[model samples]
Target chain A: GAGVSQSPSNKVTEKGKDVELRCDPISGHTALYWYRQRLGQGLEFLIYFQGNSAPDKSGLPSDRFSAERTGESVSTLTIQRTQQEDSAVYLCASSSSMNTGELFFGEGSRLTVL
Target chain B: AQSVTQLDSQVPVFEEAPVELRCNYSSSVSVYLFWYVQYPNQGLQLLLKYLSGSTLVKGINGFEAEFNKSQTSFHLRKPSVHISDTAEYFCAVMLTGGGNKLTFGTGTQLKVEL
Candidate 1:
């Protein structure tokens, strides 16, 4: 794809249900990132991946939240036992490298845990 | 740790009027600065960035920002704002030597009206 792509642009689920959001980063990009944006708050860092390995998973809010990238191409963010407070937009971004200082963003997947 | 602050939650400006969105950051090390704009129902796009060269950086849509090292501020400005420019603006900071994790501000909602 010419840009980062995210799936399930909008997802509404009941509390305690699990949800999975997918992201496909730009081709040949070596770095990928995930962030969460609450209704009226700033974006909070979630995790970062270099190639197929995750060097930084320090921002995952809880154990219920886990993410993985395969083949250095596609990534998935899964939220298990979702709570109402988990409602937010999940954003995926990709960069040519970690030091590029610029990132290409996806449209984001909006999750509404009711 | 790096942190960003956007003082104004919202800024209302008349069409063709000048506008400025303030940003401040705190970091222990040298850092890069960036401004991103999020239009309604759209993804975030990079407005501008400050790496190492000049302090003044120009971005798309006639927007510009100045990186002040002493004050640790990266204020975004526009000589004339159009109705189309109404969007949410975010300030972010990334450590120069650190990984690509971006610390973002809460964002400023610029409402350009007639």
Candidate 2:
């Protein structure tokens, strides 16, 4: 793809339900990241993937938040037992390499947990 | 550890006037600084970044920012503003030799009026 792309631009799910958000980064990019932005809050780091290495999962807020990436391509973020506080925009970004390079962002997936 | 702070939550300015958005960061190691802009219902777009060399950096849409190492600040500034410049601006920092994760500040809403 020309830029980072996210699927299901908007989602609404009830509390206790599970939601999955997908992201497809640009081709040949070796670094991908997931972030969340709650209403009136700053962007919070979720997870990061670099090449074929184990992801940097230090930013996941809780045990309910988990993510996976296939090699250096598509990534998915899964939230289990969602709560109203989970409402936010999920953002995906990719960079040419993992050396603090310029990032290309996707439009983001807006999730509304009811 | 690295964290960014955008001091002003909202800044209003008249058209054609100059504007500045303040940002500061705290980090134990070297870091990279960046500014991103977000229009309504859209994702973030990279405005500029400071990696190495000169402190002054120019970005898209005639925007510029200066990185002050001593104060740990990277403030975005524009000599003159326009109505189209109204958007949410964010300051982000990435550890120079760390993973792909980035720490972002709470955004500053820039409102340009006639």
Q: Top lDDT: which candidate number?
A: 1
Provide per-model DockQ scores: 0.83, 0.76
Q: Which candidate has the top score in DockQ?
A: 1
Model 1 agreement with the true structure over A1-114: per-residue lDDT tens digits = 599999999999999999999999999998889999998899999999987664599999999999999877999999999999999999999888644668889999999999
Native contacts recovered, each model: 0.78, 0.75
Model 1, residue A75: distance off in Å is 0.2
CAPRI-style quality class for the chain A–B interface of candidate 1? high
Interface RMS deviation of candidate 2 = 1.3
Model 1 lDDT at residue A63:
97
Q: Write the per-residue lDDT of candidate 2 for residues B1-114, one digit (tens) a residue.
A: 889999899999999999999999999999999999999877798899999999999999999999999999999999999999999999999888856577999999999999
Q: In candidate 1, what are the lDDT values of residues B1-114, reduced to their tens digit?
A: 889999999999999999999999999999999999999988898999999899999999999999999999999999999999999999999998967888899999999999
Lowest-lDDT window of 10 residues in candidate 1 chain A?
Answer: A95-104
Residue B46 in model 2: lDDT: 89
